[model samples]
Target: MSDMLSIEQREQAWVFTLNRPEKMNALAPELVLALTEGIQAAHQQKIPLMIFKGNGKNFCAGFDFSDLDTASEGDLLQRIIQIEIMLDLLATSPSMTIALCHGRNFGAGVDIIAACKHRIAAAGTSFRFPGIKFGLILGTRRFQNIVGTQNALEILSSTRTFDAQEAQKIAFMQEIREPEQWPSLIEQAEQNNAILSDVTRRNLYKVLYCSAESDQNLAALVRSASAPGLKDRIRAYLKPN
Candidate 1:
């Protein structure tokens, strides 16, 4: 289990890194479960700073669809929605999550970063919303809040890749750095994470946004995601371009 994700905790900081460099550190069910448990551990340990990144060149390549078999499309979608809900608990934890993003961010990868309080990307990294091609929905509302409605629409709609410079221009990422400079840049990011007092900022989230309703609706829709022909469509879309 530790092989899937590595967690390091200190008095003030908790770092969770995706450990599978192969397959670009893709998210498997076990990895997602470990990440949820790690977030819980951070709360119990009173850690207020959280950093999410990858062990190698990529952040996360989204859900490991290869793990799915003949499960009902509904069952698979329910699992995906469950993963989303559980992952959100990390952001709502009594910590400030800052993503040090490099390489490619696709599908749920993008959603994870959007849910973070702050993000810094390496200049060489790229961002994309592949959900459009797959006929899936992503963090539209959260992304819109970060990068604005127009850009968010364009990003989600186009499914095209964008470099870090374009990402910063749209305010999707804060700072862009060369890979060599990420260590010092992340250290500085830790300083920013320290500003939040020892308390949950979830209230701030709910005050500015009422996402529960949308979440419920999304969960319901996603739970029933076993629409006829869904699997066929997914199989077709997943074929390498």
Candidate 2:
């Protein structure tokens, strides 16, 4: 119901669309809360498949820094914490999760795609994980688990932008698909979801999900983001020479 996110049910899947195209669907606090609530609802309703997409040019641009000048460091840290919690929930969700990523995605936006079971990106989509540039460790562990330690280091260390092809090569993306091919992808996922009963599927996810390190991941993010001059680091990262 929140304007920041549009939710719709199609057959057995629930689609949650990020609706802030003007801002590249950045994860503003309100939008993050809306998405968290929507994910929770999908879990409660036992939806078999949960799909995430965005409207307009890009999937998501990452954390909203529009109000950085006015926000204290503590406020920014809390926002990052909330985003991590939401991502943990999505990553460990019982239902099958899919992300349809396109255009340019950065920071926590890339984290969202990383959390999903099925990560499909448009042909020319690109991603950058620049949280480290600001001394933030958000999603590093999960990303490493997805793309391996060496690849993660190379990508995150440089904070460089990589295209969808490179993403698939690194195993960060499961497939490179055009937007028009997405409907069939959804249908395939729906069919796959129907293969298992709700309880069985939930059990399977519980068995397969490696969340034992989630707490540690959160702690690391907190420690890094809580370091002194958090705002200064962010500002420097934003306005590079």
Candidate 3:
């Protein structure tokens, strides 16, 4: 729809590219909405696979703070809800999803990859979950599902940056690709999807993402992130240290 995202349908796959190169493909609300719409349409069309990638040097830098800086608490909560809904759709959609991440993947960017069934990162790509710095609990459960409880705690608590190798070692990233190898790997994925039947695709998704226990952490996150003093904490975190 908007230039914020580019949606294309190939023979076997629907590809959604985040197009905000100037902003490092940041997740502005409109960009999020465009992506969500693309994913929804793919599901409706029964597309076998959907690919999420960024057009810039970086995959994503996370949520655009420009809008949040002036948002009221009520407005902020609504935005968070919208993000949660979009991510949930991505995570649980019947269509298989892949995330191709490169460069800086921070905050909500990391969460986006974690939601995908398949995650491939470029060499030298770095990821960080800086929500602790903002006094928010975004994607805690999904990160836990990717890397488990102990790893998630250590990674989130330290608020330290990690590279693609470390992410793979933790099983957070399923594959790491060199710059030259991306095209072949993506082509292979497309070829593989070409032969997969809808029944098999649905079964694969169910086996992979739906087998997990019903997650209560999302609800807990909503309460924790919306509690009193969050705005104050965010202000403090954003201030020059």
Give the candidate number with the greatest lDDT.
2
lDDT of 1 by residue, 14-96 (tens): 77888988878777777877887888877787676788888788998886778556667776676677667755675455567
How much does candidate 3 score in TM-score? 0.93
Alpha-carbon TM-score of each model against the true structure: 0.87, 0.98, 0.93
- lDDT tens string, model 2, 47-125? 8899999998999999999999999999999999999999999999998999999999999999999899889999999
Record all residue pairs in model 2 with backbone atoms less than 3 Å apart, i.e. clashing. none
Order of all candidates by lDDT, from best down to worst? 2, 3, 1
Residue range with the least summed lDDT across 10 consecutive positions in model 2: 205-214
| lDDT (Cα, 0-100) at 158 in candidate 1 | 87
Total clashing pairs for each candidate: 1, 0, 0
CA lDDT of every candidate = 0.74, 0.93, 0.83
Candidate 3 lDDT, tens digit per residue, 130-203?
Answer: 87886778778888988989999999999999999999999988988865786677689988776868898798
